[model samples]
Target: MGQLERATEATLARGARLVHAHPRTLASVVALSLACFGAAAYGIAQTAPDASDLPRRLVTEIVAHEDLPSQLEALAGHELQLYRSEQTRAGDGAESLLARMGLVDAEAAAFVRRDPLARKLIEGRAGKLVRAAATPAGQLEELTARYAPANADLAGTHFDRLSITRGADGRFTARIATVPLATSVRLGSGTIRSSLFAASDESGIPDAVAVQMAEAFSVDIDFHRELRRGDTFSVVYETLTADGEPITWNHAAGRMLAAEFVNKGEAYSAVWFKDESGRGGFYGLDGKSKRRAFLASPMEFSRVTSGFAMRMHPILNQWRAHKGVDYGAPSGTPVRAVAQGIVKFAGRQNGYGNVVEVEHGNGKSTLYAHLSRIDVRQGQRIDQGVRVGAVGATGWATGPHLHFEFKVHGEQVNPLAIAKSSEAIELSPAERQRFAGVAQQIRGQLDAALTVGATVAE
Candidate 1:
């Protein structure tokens, strides 16, 4: 056993000491042991202890994995519960899952404590799911297995890893772990002023991606409040690499040009740039940083129904820091990766629920939380303006909304105001004709669509 394992074992021993002192359980245990000996003395082996003496009905508890609980619940369980776990080591599960089912209150711990060497072998870890069941006659059962981490590095970092198991006697056990993660992510920048869905549909960017594009530029444009009748944008950015393969974006670059908001009677234009210099930042056409201390959301046009502040947490009632902005909308609303990044997290989290964290270079990161469904996975590469998940209340939320957050190093910052305009790439005179051809094709499509709509109206 390593020093770390020994330390953990010693700590658990100290906690379980009180349970060993209770006379109530000792008496029942002694009585049971005597019965075992009595039967053994008569030639019956203790290996086959009397089952009739055990309880009739049983209760089992399972944690983490969804499949095991159903299997145990299928048994004639007297009662069963599925609870979250807090274990942090490999062997923490060995006994916890079955304690209730085997009616063995810390028996696993008791045995480990009795044998210091065995305790030494208990720590160090792996992932696992745990199940605990109880019998009417008063017995607990447990079962646990080594679990594999989706991200090997996360084995000890995500603390609630769990597993389920069953004993030959039909008892169930549950084990839990205790590694929690504090996350950071990154996003790219771009702008689209055309109708939300249309822009994405035309660009081959998903609706979620369009929404993200809108959100990324919202801080500077006030998309809901500020936009023009004719606006254009240009961009360049990085994509996240997973297993050495780039699949998604981690950051982006670009400009919003000629945003002709007729009502606003203004044309908005900006050059967005990512400062590769250690100073790190986005800039507007005026060379000022539009990046606020944070980003409003990673998604675009989702509508900021909730801002960051103290509010009633949909779950775990009480005031809590709403670390991100919430965009209220419908389920399955496409959520885009705000920047080029590798998905560091793509799973359920406390309060945040279904979440994805992207890590951009330079300690800058972004987070997309409170999602109903995730389209990506841990270590997956993503591009800026790519669909990474969908908006919905998967965690502690009041309704369908995307929770967007920006973090520098580890601190949250406003995503808006991040000057996305740095420098606009111009089509070389040689490439101008080619670019114009593409532009004309788009213009032709727009004209056709408007004409058809007019005819239909008439």
Candidate 2:
């Protein structure tokens, strides 16, 4: 035999002898040998050279790109002609609003006024989007108005849709429908640099939302006076959408569910909650309503021309205790009633000139002086923030300004100081329990929103 054949036979003979002497040990050795042989074979295969250019096979097919049909392109052009918008003013009538919407169809206007269903589209609440599709020649073809019902679930989860379409025969059909809208909570946090609106604009929050936020906390925080440069605010509110598109911010009827404002290192929070009676109001975490008996000022936002202190009278030219605060505004500015009360007086009063006094419960009352016109009658009941008169320089003043006074038990107390002590309405025992649950849920959402805002900011 050759040398290789002789070696193989010799190795087999040695293993057979070991098996006969120690069978278990010989079996283990045989298994180990087989394992090593498999590993060596695998290593050799891995180290083998790649057959990159070994052989070549080719297969080809032709594919053609399809172009959009001309009809489809025309349809898209028509769709682009659809005019979409939101109702801007509460005083806008069907004619004005339709004209603004570029719908010059007089028949549409008549239908809106006469048909109840069509009237719903035209005369319903403002702050809703009204869409119109017109022919290339500017003739109205279709119109749609969408708004949230007062009872819409959880802020913008539903929308009431009104559709008006012109038939091919020139007849108009109107119908009302409900559409499901996607609801999402958006969080925005802003630090004031110059003004609230400015900060809101910088933070991507709408000015309307910013105004609402200020109103929500106005009882405790004077946006005009108390706002500081570094004051921060975090807001969590609702946004409604359809077909993955969000509605206009003006028409977004969602409430500010939660808000946190850190002014001068003091934190204030407001959470929206509805009691058992379905009365919804903003309350603190402890279930105290943020609504005070009076707003800090008669105006929503204005600069203080003069404070409630001794100042030289422009007309008298003598130093006297200014019983009320003066807010500088234009002459036709609408003055607001500071509190809910009967119109105690609504006319001129010597140096006070055109003035209105409203007496409230607890022997409290407010006085608004210096007016160009009076809108209330004596003994007529009025609510807070109602237009009492217009700002004018009719009183003993050099310019148009509102002189506001707060009286408690017939004695004048600085309105600013009284506003600080304005009482808050506390929820009842049962109401408090319900509010706690709602508060807890809102708290969780606020935290998540704040975290998301922080991440985006980073």
Candidate 3:
């Protein structure tokens, strides 16, 4: 017989002898094979170092449950792969992620961008990926990258493939990771009779978030007298990393929900948008433009109780034109940040109360007056809605309301009409595909999460 035939006969005879001697071993092997059929790899981690043309990676999360009454361990297996570059960023990344999903590069990214949460994942950027087999706990896996670095001669970085996969099951592949693509937080509602701030105190929105929400909508509404009762809001934002912390929110983002002035007869609803051209604006419920050429009222819910015209000045009784607007509210009524900018002046002024002036770029500066206190300092960077101070009759004010002013460069202008605007966050054409792929993958995770209880931890 040929060498192959002789070897086959010998192997079969040995197996038959062993099976006759130990019947239980054969039964156990057959049972295990059926249990883990397509879910298990035979020579996976045990592949010889010299072997090439390796099989594709394993995809599965091995979720363990302590409560299930079965004696056999429950197997929660799902496959996933995420690549980070045009070459590697497929599977879980966009073009790269889609490529990993066994799709053509172009198709993967298109799918991801079609969803909102997926577009957000590319923005959230944890910068690493996960691929698992036989486990639900995210296991760390080794990965590859194309770091197109410029050098003296070479114009692009080369690809470096590395791996760090987990052996057994648990969360995190044994490697460094990128942040997840999206983030969310739950909040409760509250009622207010006076202002949004008072109502926010009763809601779960921290003062910081409350301030930002007001600032985001300041272009359209006045918060001081506008907020009455049952006003509500929700946001979906960026995730950033300062040190080691996984950030939950970044201001360069979009918000999905907001409501206000229901206590009054008037009601307003809007979705904030930063368009692809980098212009930020507001859209009303009908998607009609709520944005005037210039944004009206630097702070929302704060009104133009005092207008830009001739008046008997409150402190200096003279028929002089009031160059700005006065926002009438109670003392210690926390003042809002009118727009995204830097603090240029945060101290006493000639006749203004504990004033805080902000430079909103493009030569625009807004001033807040009649403060019981100042919360920001000179040269400090603050956002649009952060509280700069509490209102009080400080400098030359007859009452608690704040004297607000808007200026262009050094010249004074009406605070109701700021014309220049800031840009919004967007994805480039190349990035769009990548963004979409990531969203699709996350949708898969979301689907899985919905099917399986997160109470799996329970």
Candidate 4:
């Protein structure tokens, strides 16, 4: 029929002829195959026995049932305590807060309103974690609230505990104590679809951690302008908790331990390291300090309302050169000093509104205009991140915004360019060896973070 079929048939014919020519040999081969199959059958029959031939045994035991009357009596004697937790909200009064926690004790509410220590629950800032133990009848038995301590210096390391308990005399007693906070490491990863905050929110990262991430990479990336869609980041940070519950106030996020940001397909990494002097800062895995002479932006994160370019002035309605970048944020937003410097001028000027001028060494000076209020006075030394003022619409501004300007020898220059060109400090030789170990550990953490990001992307 075809060349292939004809070839196959010829081969088969040759094979048949060979078989016929070696009839005795073929018979011997068949006998050996039969013998091997018989041996295999016999071995299988000997190894496997019938189910009925295998050993069999019957076992039985009696299970005793508990007496129902005795069980009911035990349960009746057990105290039925209900536990509930709620967060304090703004405008929450004693009655409202107790009601939210499913508590309905008039005496408890009256004590909360009258007692000085219990009044602290509703006073001051809100968002305190409140846990209450109540009876089956919805009467509050004990109440405890945890929040940031009154002392700002101890806010990061301790929390204020306000506890109220019902005494044997049917009276409520309240006490306040400061307790040390616990620290825990956390890992998070996200892909940028819109903004860093949005990504961080989707990844369940706290706002404080996101702010720290932005600040850690402030010198390398201008979060206001450089963030791109599809960019990804992985972060390792410390979270402070009170009695195992995460704290919510006082910027309770501990410190950013390590982070890796892939912006525009280029990856940047940072790790926190403390020197023997107990001074700590974020450094690249290569041991290069991330701190620069100047930060790219005065605010942690904000959108640019105006750039350094010529545009129609909102007040003048005519084309004029805009010397500084305008950051659009709510009024009273703290404006930080971009570099450590001495306050040269901290007063209002014509068309500049309330302003603070800082004289950084090397003929470099920076100005923050349209400030609602100035915190630093003239001739005061301020650190790079120290708050100089707050955003405002004072002077010639139309809306609330921070107008930031950088000057080189009395001439205005682009602040972003100047910050990017600033030199970065390198680790000392003595610290390099220790830093290498830290970097190695951080590198593994980053790799794990990358895997987490990839999983989230999927």
What would the TM-score be for candidate 1 when compared with the true structure?
0.36
What lDDT is reached at residue 340 by model 2? 87
C-alpha lDDT values of all predictions: 0.53, 0.80, 0.53, 0.92
TM-scores, all candidates, are 0.36, 0.61, 0.35, 0.80
Return the lDDT, model 3, position 89: 31
Q: For model 4, what is the error of residue 265's alpha carbon versus the real structure, in angstroms, after optimal superposition? A: 1.4
Whole-model alpha-carbon lDDT for candidate 4: 0.92
**Candidate number that wins on lDDT, 1 or 4:** 4
* Model 2 spans > 4 angstroms off: 1-185, 239-254, 312-320, 330-334, 361-363, 381-387, 390-393, 397-399
333-386, model 4: which lDDT tens digit per residue?
A: 999999999999999999999999999999999999999999999999999899
Could you tell me the lDDT of residue 35 within candidate 1? 94
State which candidate has the highest TM-score.
4
- Candidate 2 lDDT over 66-161, as tens digits, reads 567976777777745656565646887778887887767788788878888888764646677777888766677888877765454634466677
RMSD to true structure for each model, in Å: 36.9, 11.2, 28.2, 9.4
Candidate 3 has an lDDT of 0.53
